[model samples]
Target: MLSWVPLLTVALLCWIFSAGQPYGLPIAVWAEDSSSLARQLVRMLDATPGLSVRAQLLSRAEAQQALQRMDVYGVVHIPPHFARDVQRGGAASVTLLHNAQLSTASSLVQRDVRQVVGTLSAGVEMQAMAKRGTPAQALQVRLEPIRTQLVALFNVSTNYEQFLAATLLPALLHILAMTAGAWSVGRELRDGTLGQWLGAPAGEAQAPARPSAAQVLAALLGKLALPLVSLWLCGMAGLVYLSQLRGWAVAGSLAWIALGLLLLIAVSLAAGALLAAGTLSLRQAMSGAGLLSAPAFAFSGVGFPLLAMSGSARTWAEAMPYTHYARLQIEQWQMGAPPAQSLPVIAVLLLATLVLLALATAALLRAWARPQDWGKR
Candidate 1:
């Protein structure tokens, strides 16, 4: 029914973008002959757009080796007799061994090769007909498209698991931090627990002079350390797992990665504190947190390259504290840079966090200064 329109719309959109996207296609080729003809075909395919040739098997045995290893999408074979058969006007066939898992690119390669062969077959037929040779025998031309050379950049291996795992780590870290910080402060406000903190008897209080800003800051920092360390450990574990298990390459130093992680936590904590101060209750803070998540994700350059975004969107992304730290993380972790290079950026984030915490404390003070309605109580 039309009642499910929004759900259906989302589902359809997800399918459209996810289905048959060529960003992660893996294609492989194996040629037997290594003849001028075979070389020509290989060159053409290598030059062909969209497909990335991962590796070329040197022999039929190598092709078998690749197939057993499950290293490629498809294996192309140019029979040793291809050139002879074409010259003798007899039909020849090229064998393509393909993995069932990489169906999309395999199918595409199959169709593309067939189209090329069809064109060549037409020419062979025309020549035979012109020579009055009864247009050849059962088959015209048999030259099969074989393995092609492919050069790739950044993600040369074409491993989807590695790609996703690497990028998702930093994004997830920042997201969870944002959620935790926002929820923690918001929960206290929404549950009216803040009143308890604000209303504790002076003598009963735990050795403090009217709960100063420094005390609150120290308390929040102390409370945050456990979660912050946990998040940092989680990020490191993800990076290590991907690198060791999946062969994900990281371009940054471990120290730099740690710095980035710390910066991201700082950014989230600052944003959460600011939100807490602005909102009257936990419900409002939670709503604000929800509103911040999507923009933070989008602005972090996970969905699209920040530079490619429109003018205003690009500006917004640049302005976002999370965006800067995310970029620093990627550069430090995936790109493999030293920690020293990120010092200035980390310092900036720390300073910004301090500024936001100061602002939140100011707001908290203003709230505390408000005259109480003891009559109702």
Candidate 2:
């Protein structure tokens, strides 16, 4: 039987990453004067993407209390003389109080607030210019000369749920599949059932029971077949249900997702076989496999772009099968890039799968020949 430790670890990691999806980090508003201008500003902030104004606090004390209670990630404080200053053609400022501990949420709040303030300032300046009889074309040219249009592809909103969650699901499955594969083989070795598993002849026969290479391969496949199927199904569930429900732009077809899942399963099974053949006992095999696959999530270009890494780091990341799979996912699913564009990455995944499978086969064959080393610690 497999231990529950690894399963619990995977579950906890999944929950921690997925919980950031819902509110997208809601913010709070504090309109000190309760004036028309202040209310309008609050409304604009509330409507901003990736941020929602959930609380309306009357005082700084109340806003601070909300922050302390974790009711809001940030607070926008509009001063009492904000409207009066604007009417008098004097500069008016609004203060933003944010929880620095939540860096991503705080950064989003700061960016949205800055954009709102800039838009309002531009309008105010344009009105002044109009009052002075400035031409409309001149005002337009002065405000925006280049007029660069930003077309965000794939993830338009850049929602954390869609971007992070999509990549995380497959990476987690890879880890679990690899770990389970190792456990399946390692348990048989530890419990002295490997000979029976491989269908070797009974002991005390003068000639040693030599199972053919095909028989050894079949035994390994039998151990991993269920796990590979289960992981593939989970991958499909995440791609279809979670990803589609989030409104993420999937590729033109499900073929890309299916191909990536198959590659991931192949690599995972290979990793498991290698670990089982190398380790002496079930505990060692499971631990080694866990360590091997755990860091894959970080280095797979999920949170950081591969191009931004140092040359050596980039080369190292490329060596990981997950890195290629991740690249294929972003190119196909997120960027909506054609399969041709992802051919190089797909090639890498295919090559890695083949090479790892070959290595695993050789190692397992050696272990099968020397059954005395199966449970040696």
* Clashing pairs in model 2, backbone N/Cα/C closer than 3 A: none
CA lDDT, candidate 2, residue 185:
77
Best-fitting candidate, measured by lDDT? 2
Error of 2 at 144 (Å): 3.8
In terms of TM-score, the best-performing candidate is: 2
Per-residue lDDT of 356 in model 2: 66
- Per-residue accuracy of model 1 over 1-377 as CA lDDT, tens digit each: 11233224323433343322354344566766766666666665565554556787778788878777877667777788676787688887877777766665676667666665566556665665657655345333323325357766455544444454455556656666666666655554555454345544443322233567875666566655666777766666656655555455576675666666677776776677567656655556556766776567678785578778999988888767677776676667555666776777788788887887787666655544442411111
Judged by whole-model lDDT over C-alpha atoms, candidate 1 comes out at: 0.62
Worst 10 residues of 2 by lDDT: 1-10
Candidate 2 local accuracy as lDDT?
Answer: 0.75
